[model samples]
Target: MPLSFFSGGGETGDLVRSYDWTSTSLGAAESWPQSLRTTVSTLLLSPVPIVLLWGEDGIMIYNDAYSVFAGGRHPRLLGSKVREGWPEVADFNDNVMRVGLAGGTLAYKDQELTLYRHGRPEQVWMNLDYSPVLDEEGEPAGVLCILAETTERVAAERRRAEAEAAVRESEGRFRALVNASSDVVYRMSPDWTEMRRLDGRGFLADTEEPSVLWIERYIFPEDRPRVRAAIDEAVGTRRAFELEHRVRRMDGSAGWTFSRAIPVLDGGGRVVEWFGAASDITERRNAEAALAELNATLEVRVAERTAELQRAEEALRQSQKLEAIGQLTGGVAHDFNNLLTVIKSSTDLLKRPDLAPERRERYVAAISDTVDRAARLTGQLLAFARRQALKPEVFAVCDSVRALFDMIGTLTGSRIRIMTRLPPAPCFVSADPSQFDTALVNMAVNARDAMDGEGELTISVGAVDQIPALRAHPAVPGAFVAVSIADTGSGIPRDRLEQIFEPFFTTKGVGQGTGLGLSQVIGFAKQSGGEVMVESEVGRGTTFTLYLPRVVDGVRPSDDSAHEPLMDGHGMCVLVVEDNPDVGTFAVQTLSDLGYRTVLAATAEEALTELATDAARFDVVFSDVVMPGMNGIDLAREIRRQHHDLPVLLASGYSHVLAQNGTCGFELLQKPYSVEQLSRLLRKVATWQRRARIMSQ
Candidate 1:
């Protein structure tokens, strides 16, 4: 039974002869059965790998090819049992042995198995064919296996199948991306001749047409050249291109689009294809354009609103000016009517043929007093108008207040208690002393009226370093002497405080007050480089503070000549220039009564004619300051030029020209003058002219 009996001269035959098989269940090779020997000889002689399992143990026998398949276990497995040789595939081999010993054949194509080869476990596939080897009597004997390892062929086929599946999945994802996109995705040939494919059909009106034709038709005519140029450039240079252009939509409406593409290049540095996408940007562009238009409209509207606001402010100012003028007219009419009543009554009373001397004297005195009061009233109006001429002098505020206390008490009546708080030292201020006294008296009377005739009126004088409340006042910032008149009386309302300084704005009932008192006080303070402030609350008393700029210089001496006896004109010729005929007659009569020979002229021009006719005829010219044509100041200037020796006196009730041009180097006397006052002014001018003439001679 030794394989030498059925000799074969191959590598497997030599390995079988050298291998020790006595320890195996098949026993020594020479003890092997003849049938097994013949099967081994036949397997050894085969070209493909073949193995034979003999007897009940299914002892292993293999050819050279089979030995190669056995890898590192070949020599040892040559005579071993099949299970012992390939333990990993033992159960499979057992089924093959069982079926083959039953005289049946078993075959498997690409059967999978795990085997120990080269001393390590390996996964392999094989095509196995099993057949039974018969004994001498033709009973079942052994299993003869013909096998081919198909590991490499099967692995290659599996790799090819996986590759195909991956390609399919990748293409599926790509198509999904294209179909789901909002932008139109496209590919074009390298020559830019045609579009290869396109996705996102919803963006196109004619999906069946080529992309180039679609673009030509749907794109705005104006944008065709640029889009064509961009595509050409991308193809020529093999570079990315981007552009934004207008497109005509399917609805025949225009919209905007942004298109971009990158050229695909081949290894030869030639353009292969271009991949591109176009996005709808119509809404964004429209919104931007609308915002620009809205900004322009907003600018125009803002300008219109600003102009309207300016116009409203100008109209308000004009309305306030007109109201002030009406108030001034009303107040002037009321006061003049009152003065006329007194004068008319007195004149009518004097007209009685048998009037008693005492009654006549009393009427004349009443007329004189009323005339003075009227002149004072006109002066107050001028002061409030800022037209009154000021004769400023440095005076002690404390001393002035002290001197006026008794007079203020009398003016307030016995019902009001007068209190004075004067600083220890004199606080000097530069102002017209008379106007200052008038301001004080006006404030006191206002307080008395507010108190309803029974309240304490406290007048306090002090020096202030800084008055924060007067920061906005027109007065220059500096030290000031504050004369505050506070009254324990009904306070002014908060809403009416700002209007209190306006002329004719009053709380007193009609006919009770002229409403010019506080206005005049405010004007006086402002004109004297000062200001007035008031603090009041309902149910609390009001305090009015007059802040006059402090004077650092010595007090000016008072004029003692004011108390001088009245001097007559002594029959000197006088020329009276007045605009009104009745006023001209009154002036002429008044001068004549003052013992002057008077001539009447209704205008400054008429007065100039009279003086030109006989320059030396009139020793003095007394002219009203305001007239139709040339004013009193102009007449005086002409007289001074022609008749240098003549004396000129200018008088006015209220003259804007006088206020603007000042006295013009001439003497000024307030209007509605008493006969005595006229006599005194005429005498003073005549005397001064006489002395000047004597000195010249």
Candidate 2:
């Protein structure tokens, strides 16, 4: 049965007294059926915080549940006013009554209500709903309420909102930082189909296009696949990524870009996206290219300079070799000349009235012929060795070429025809006349040999403002005197052209030629600031072109012959030391013939013994550089110990060894000398002695 139809004993206060059970025949009837009474009573009395009120009057019938909810309000308080029953919540009850009486359902979804129930004080959030009861006339009466507490759910919701706000704020800061950077910052999906990017320059802007569209349009076509792969790798491994690629700009130009990225991962360790920045590096790349090109150019220049240095070193080596040859030749000539002096003196002594006329004449003629041969040999040696120091004077090439015509006639032996083409005007060059003559003779001799003694040789001298391809001759461009020697002889082979200037490299057969001729000519020309060029073909002829730098001054005459006069030593006791018996006897004889009283010492010990035995005798000591026991220089020193003022002359076959000995206060004489040179050296020594005596005084 519904609670509205239930009646207990008799209708109490505010009850509808017209109801049949409450008013008809039993105002206070207890004769109701026990089940009905029990059912009605239970409906009105069971507990669950239910309260029945009769307007502002009181609780009409409060259940055990309502008494428990009220925390000590008794059921005996029924029919009492609600303020007397629960004074503490009088204001709450009045507000609820007003809402219910106005016919509105007052619902609280989550409302916190505080109450002191049985001294257990606490707050409970409840979902409360109130519904009003009606009288028989349909007037609003008491209200019924239903409530449920949800404090935990409300608190949980508030905590979740706070945490979300914090995460959003942190993400906003990160986005700001990416936008403020100079590089283009971006994020991408693992497949790279979707992109999120932050424009570094546009962080401050209020709005801009999405990063995804920007990358899709701007990524260079060629680099897109590679960039995607890089991003995918970073995502899969959750590692950092770095790559360089080209970006196609909006204007269709490509820019080199360097990108660096780090992968962002979720809690499951799966890649979510990639965060990266790409910087434009086109300028740096261009600079590196330019630097590479410059370095290559510098390398080429250094190689060229090194080649030039090597050439210069070769030239210096050649000069030193020639100098060495000269020294050797000069030594031999000195020794030979000394022997010649002895022979000549002996012949002169034999020519005296003591001999038969026919025999004397025969000796004279023989000596004369022998002297001529020796002189010729000396001259050839000097020329080949390049030892005869030139006395260079400014001379015209035209005059030199003209003067060499007669010499050419004699040297060529009429087998080769000589033609001269002289320059119309004078062309000056600094050179020795004899050297120029010798150079001409050599060229003519070579030509004659090339022609097999029967071809025409043309010698042409001309002034050139500039040489023909002279700059290509490994020399600089300048004015030159071109003396071209053209021969119609058997031509030189093309392969042999460069070798012509190399000493001892000759095409002529052994014993017929010494290959120093052209080499000497080249040396002389270079020393004179000129260069030599040769053009040859196998069957055709050869032309040796000499380009000597031009000079301004004309020919200046110089003394060609300043021969030393024969000097007889003035009874100066001299010491001669040598290890070779033939050389020793020859030197002693030569000195004896020169009127010097001589003493012979074959070694340093002998020289010292001779000096000790005859302390005040010798005025000069002459010795060869190398010997068996003691050398010449040491011998000279020992001789000087006894004769302090004595002049010492050191002779050597190899002149370079003499340079190392540091000859101070001593004179040096290369061997193989002429009688005249011996006489001159003796006179010089006598003069130096006389000067020394004066200085002592």
Which window of 10 residues has the lowest lDDT sum in candidate 1? 467-476
Residue lDDT tens for model 2, 1-697: 1334344423221232223334322223255434333433543544344454545453344454455455544433454666665566688767887878776668878877666555566565667777776655676666666544566787777678988898898889877776666676777675556656566352222224454554456667788889778866866667888888877643567677788877677999776777777787878878988999999999999999999999999999888778645654455556566658867876787958778887777777667666655554444444444453333568877777777788787877777788888866788887755567667677777887788878789998877776565435544677788888998877877666777776566664434445556766776565556777788776668888887777865656663223666677768888888888898899899888988889888887887788788757878888887787777777777767757788888776543234343454567665556666677777777789889999999
RMSD of 1: 18.2
lDDT of 2: 0.67
RMSD of each: 18.2, 28.5
lDDT of each: 0.82, 0.67
- What candidate 2 gets wrong by more than 4 Å, as runs, is 1-404, 421-438, 460-484, 490-493, 523-531, 535-541, 545-565, 577-579, 601-654, 657-671, 684-697
Question: On residues 115-172, what C-alpha lDDT tens digit does candidate 1 reach at each position?
Answer: 8897778889999998899988899898888999999999899889999999899889
Steric collisions counted per model:
0, 13
Candidate 2 weakest ten by summed lDDT: 9-18
